[model samples]
Target: MTATSRSLSFALKSATVRSSSGHFLRELLANEHLPQDELQARQDHAARAIAEQAMQESPFYRRLYGERGIDPRILDDPRRWAELPILDRATVKAHSGEFATPEAVGRGVRTALTGGSTGEPLRTLHDARVPSLALAWRMYSWWGIQPYDDLARIGRWSFGRMDAVKNTIAWWPTRQLSLDAAVISEETMTEFHRAVTRVRPRLLEGYVGALLELADFLERRGLRIPGPTAVATTAAPLTAPVRARLEDAFEAPVHDEYRGSEFGWMAGECDRQDGLHIFSDVRRIEVVDADGRPAPPGEEGDLVITDLRNRVFPMLRYRNGDRGILRERSCPCGRSLPLMEPPQGRTIDVLHLPSGASLAHRLTALFSAHPESVRLFQIHQQADASLTIRVVPGPGERSRRHVEDAVEDLRTRIRHEVPVRIEYVESLPYTGGKTKYILSDLPAVVPQAPTPPPDTPSVRA
Candidate 1:
């Protein structure tokens, strides 16, 4: 066997114990070389298989189709597949367990919880692990990441004893080191620099917001660390400016990836970096108009995805609550996967702490400290590592003790010496009809001076 196949086989075997199935990497590699027409045919075949399996094993999907007087067998028609009803977040939230495959009831399926835009949390169950890991591996390989490579991530992670132990065993093969994204203060950045210096990982990956903050912090201090071959950003919209800044700061190419807590690794930037290539072989991705019909190419619409492999909780034509555009043209790299713009919306800011914890950590602190009277709120992190909570309260006067107790709760959760202040506001700002929830005041871009020639002496102005 070839070296690539041998390594992939070992990785697949290692992953099988934790996953419900294996043999994904081999199929994934084979699909990579398929032409666009052949890939679409395979995708349709997989989509039909998902529909049939859902009808047979999932009571929720069975009833959903039955109630509409529609036969699941009709979805077998490739052209009629688009005629199926579009599933929204509310449907999933209202009928959570109904979506899970009955066959996986006793199996150890994975659960994912994500905070929705309306402040309600939606939970999803994943029956398949192959698609996620395979898609991620494909994208990372574009940036020279391989199985068993060291990948350092900067994000919110708790260091409790049991959690740490679980992380150690789970991440041993990947050799992932976690840095706190909740706090990116001077001290936190210093420790991060130290960790990177020591580990010298080949890949740096994390939320775009935190990575941008780190890049800014490092650039401002005139500090640079080497050995990272590539940097990857996720969990937020990666604009051209942000990508440029990150590339400059890391001194490496920055690859932006698009995915969510519900569905993992939806699309990612190829080496071309022009736009994200959607994994159409494993997923049926569509940009649909408000009427749920396929939107015209280059037009922005709601991102609807149907994962072919996730049988536990079938996410067929599920609206992902994000907006993006589908490219009309193919990628220059000649990959058959369809191209997409980076998803826009649902971004949070990082709250720096003395000890590394981030993303979810700061979010937990904020939600725990949420006042009963507050209807809407936004959290902002100041340059001094202090946090300000701006709230649009309900009708009533909130007592000073209530505010103090909330502040104390936040302090207790953060477990750090940072000022937490609450400000009542009439209304909070919105970006594109959605509340930003979290905002950062730190500078993400720094101006660089031109380099002086080595042969020419610097002139005093």
Candidate 2:
């Protein structure tokens, strides 16, 4: 009958009606905090189950493992997990259809697509619901926020029909606030900060760049909005200096999250500020050198991850070309889960306008939303503030009109009548196993300046 238990009971009851986590949502909070050995046992069990099911169900894995005479049971032993071949993007692309389990797709799943480093669209069959939602709640718990606590997010969101309806009908009951960062300026931040001060969300989450922009606005205006217990930043790197600035601006602790569209959340920084704790129960993360061997201790290397949760498209030893160091040291917070430095790849430079508006919005995130229209793309920013988007056209079947729409949308988002042009290219350079999304000759550091007066007409923000 304790308050904490009561809240947990209520949260579970709420999820019972809608959760599509395959019954795992019930154990999310409990399992995430288990003792080291017990958590490892659970991780091994889930990893083995996924591997076994994938080998038995997926045409791709069945064929690969059968041809090699490898048993999926090896994963059960933990130590033998590495005997399996590292699954590369090229192989997955070549056998995309075979990677999907037809049975799981029939049971209902969503298609997750990405314009991978090579400017080629790639797809993964994702479950209808991801456990990361509950995992995020667990992260908030670290800051004394409960699962049902009011939360707010400031990021680029789809304001489509579904989200619009949710923004109205489910807004209060869900106690969630969605502050769109589709366009950012002093005017928009003024309104957003006003709303935040009114609602006083317990947890505020946003892209690092957008949050920094909002923070700058707050600082320059000498305004302080209190009452958010903590701020969570993602989508881009949160370096030491940036984290310090956000903390000072918000007057609250700032936490960093490393996530992806294909895989929900891989790691989240705890309050201790030690390092990011890998959600090892749902992901098996590894660091390897260029040769794919384990990196020397303490050295930075490529981060390869295995999806222990995704059964529809089992990501066994998948590498997305991200580089980071997987630390062996334990966290001072006493969490037994392995710690990792924030990932180093996939983060690109934000385009800073002459007006000091930084387009922290990732072009890759925008392009991925129109997967059918963008096979691959790179944004080149000239010193004159003109932008040339070098595009490799995606399939025209589902995206013929979307291509132009996405470009126009991008132009509107950048505002300032910044000259945004498109150059049709057969291919763009995707070197180093990572896409260099924005090649900007602009200076790396742009000084903060006051936003334009409210009278200045602005686009969506």
Candidate 3:
């Protein structure tokens, strides 16, 4: 096609997509208040459809399920997602090619690479609209923000020239002013602050670390941005102290958003902000125990999820390596979708002691409690199993005292003496443009094994 003709064709196609997406957005808004039974029915229908598609079209699921004696016809029977084996990132990485299917929702599927936040990078596949829909439902539908509202974002922009332009084009329509999270300095932040204040967007959104850093910088300089209706933080754990500072500094209500790079947006906060409402319509989510069976409701465990909409590369039971709890009740926002405790941290962050293991947030509880004294901290479990905490002092003068107190408090709670060391620093050094709140110097990652189904069939290549 000629260049001008191609441009004209693209513009026409874009208009059609926008019109249909507007209708889909309205349909999603309508689905928000659906009764529990109706929501379950929708989820069931989607799950059955996705599951059948995977078993039939995706080579990975067909072989895996067949070898485990899971007949494709079994999807016709009423079943929970837990009945199928738990799928982890490690397994997906090993058999990635087997996962792909020709099916898709939008134009077609494309490759997606994760940030390797858990120290292992992942490559997955997704269609275009699934991600757009995820973000829209999370922010626009759930958070009660409008799609066309002016938004200011602080996030990592790609270093590549071409990738950077792609990012710009993707976000261009949102009327968002974005600042690169990688380049945060007094000069850059000042420029960003000036720009944001000038725009006065309705909502401010960014990674947890970037937002906190901006809040700290603004607080230090005594410069405040007067008017953001709301703040949304994601990409890392948003502790209470972090949320408070963002709200205080921005002068707005702060909400936490939960998502995975491998999977699209899974859950996020609504206007009520009590808990994250899992996007159950597109995601079949469960909190699974270490053995991969569903954890009892209200108990925290690893999250095993399946994307019901992404037939392009169906993730049947993907353990994206994050851990949290599923609330027994629905959100107070009147959505029938199930609620979940917001992600505390990735499973890799969970500290393994000789006696027992502690969740990442619990281990950081003391430091999080002393936010005035400790600006940032990382809990590292050495190969020898000794624990070392590296802390960056806050603007407050009581860093040593608060660190001592945290050590003492942790000792009491764990009730066991483990070799523990403290290292103080001016800042948490960045690795790949982000800071790690928890690290493991251990040799390797332990694989999680799921319970096997009965009546197995033979394996095939």
Candidate 4:
């Protein structure tokens, strides 16, 4: 091999070995076979260590806790965690640099940007080791993807020119791995089919919408690529219909990964598909009701996450715009991580009715009820119970009554007495960055009521 080729080969081999070893350790740590009490004890220890580190390192936490009149010493008791105020996307954006530890940032850390579904893009920095650990955590929990076997990643890299080098370097630890961004396009589905057949990847990972489109294309062309051992879908919402199609097309179990740019990999789906298992070791997650109190087990609430591992830019009690119910039940697979059944779509999909009560998670159900007629759709609710339903009909007779019935069903579910307007168009618009199928156009409006303040603790940095 040439000098460059030799270097690439060596890098690939080294990455594979490192990944395999990391995964082995993570699996041991996360194994459900361990006694529940033992796991809880371990988690408690890790949480304390992380909280202490944040109090010492992060300026944002130092100020936040000081203002809230909290003592960092109280971190020893996990029960006092709720005293820390929750952080949201808005707060993070407003105070990005303050969250960073000066020492960590000085060490040549990397940065990641989030094009959140709410139309706000925020950038945050992390230590260099974070991505590798994030990947290891994902491999151990989701697909069992080891270091060197060939694999394919199908999403667009947010970075432009850097992507070519990043993609090349990402495959260095594993031999025979190929990264393909072309899979995002419907027209490139044929190309993807040919490439996958050639590479015969061990794992397939990418946006759920792109994968679903490719699957539809394959189904139409009567073609089947070599089946991968595991498939991981992320980046976009995975509706029931889309997920079902992916499983059928790949002829393999599909794993859904719940992650954000801020928090690398928060939760993962196992073979059982009961619910996504939250990564309790890496991050602390809380499901809080509308009143900001802890939601009971199996009750839907906002997903609040604290990235204990990300001390360079701490994400304490960050409000992820997704909602889900925390299930107290243990998984049959024997993993000890907490379980969460994420609400199907983004928070935007939930409409607010005229009666001041917000609608629930029945939008997906409404669409699934008439799957054959609707191809793609998006719904947005305005302030006065006025709603807009945008639909992109598939190739068939456009049934006005069926479309009207679907809207009526959604209206009935959302509000007993409210009006809705349905608009059918040739194609729905894409968000300038990613092709997110669901969106909420509601303006960010914080309530005027002086709510119970977040738990405040003082940190000395």
Which candidate has the top score in TM-score? 2
TM-scores for all predictions: 0.79, 0.85, 0.70, 0.67
- Report the Cα lDDT for residue 293, model 4: 83
lDDT: which is higher, 3 or 4? Answer: 3
List, residue by residue over 82-172, the lDDT tens digit for candidate 2.
7777877657766777887765646457777665544455677776545456777666677777666667778755367787786656433
lDDT of 3 by residue, 1-461 (tens): 23355345435534674655555556666776799889888888888888888988999999998899876556566465557888865588668778888675346776665534443334688866553553454455455565555678776432477876775576454445777664355766788888888877778887776676677678789999768888888777766656656776888888888766677677788778778888787788888887787788889888788888787888887877677898888766677878889875543234555643333333434454444465556777788887787876655567689778877777665555477888887777765334566788766433222232585442311
Q: How close to the true structure is residue 348 of candidate 3, measured as C-alpha lDDT?
A: 28
Error of model 2, residue 64, in angstroms:
3.1
Choose 2 or 3, whichever is better by lDDT: 2
Model 4: residue 99 alpha-carbon error in angstroms:
1.0
Better of 1 and 2 by lDDT: 2
lDDT score at residue 3, model 2, on the 0-100 scale: 43
lDDT (Cα, 0-100) at 434 in candidate 2: 62
Q: What's the candidate order when arranged by decreasing TM-score?
A: 2, 1, 3, 4
Error of 2 at 291 (Å): 1.8
Write the residue-wise lDDT of candidate 1 on 10-112 in tens digits: 4675567634223565567567778988998889889888988887778888898878876767756788887788987667866776888765655447766
- lDDT winner among the candidates? 2
Models sorted by lDDT, best on top: 2, 1, 3, 4
| Per-residue lDDT over 93-211 for candidate 4, one digit per residue giving the tens place of the 0 to 100 score | 66776778765645557776554554334578765555445444444444666545566665543245677567667555443333333213344556667778887776877766556
Question: In model 1, how large is the Cα lDDT of residue 11?
Answer: 69
lDDT of each: 0.71, 0.73, 0.68, 0.62
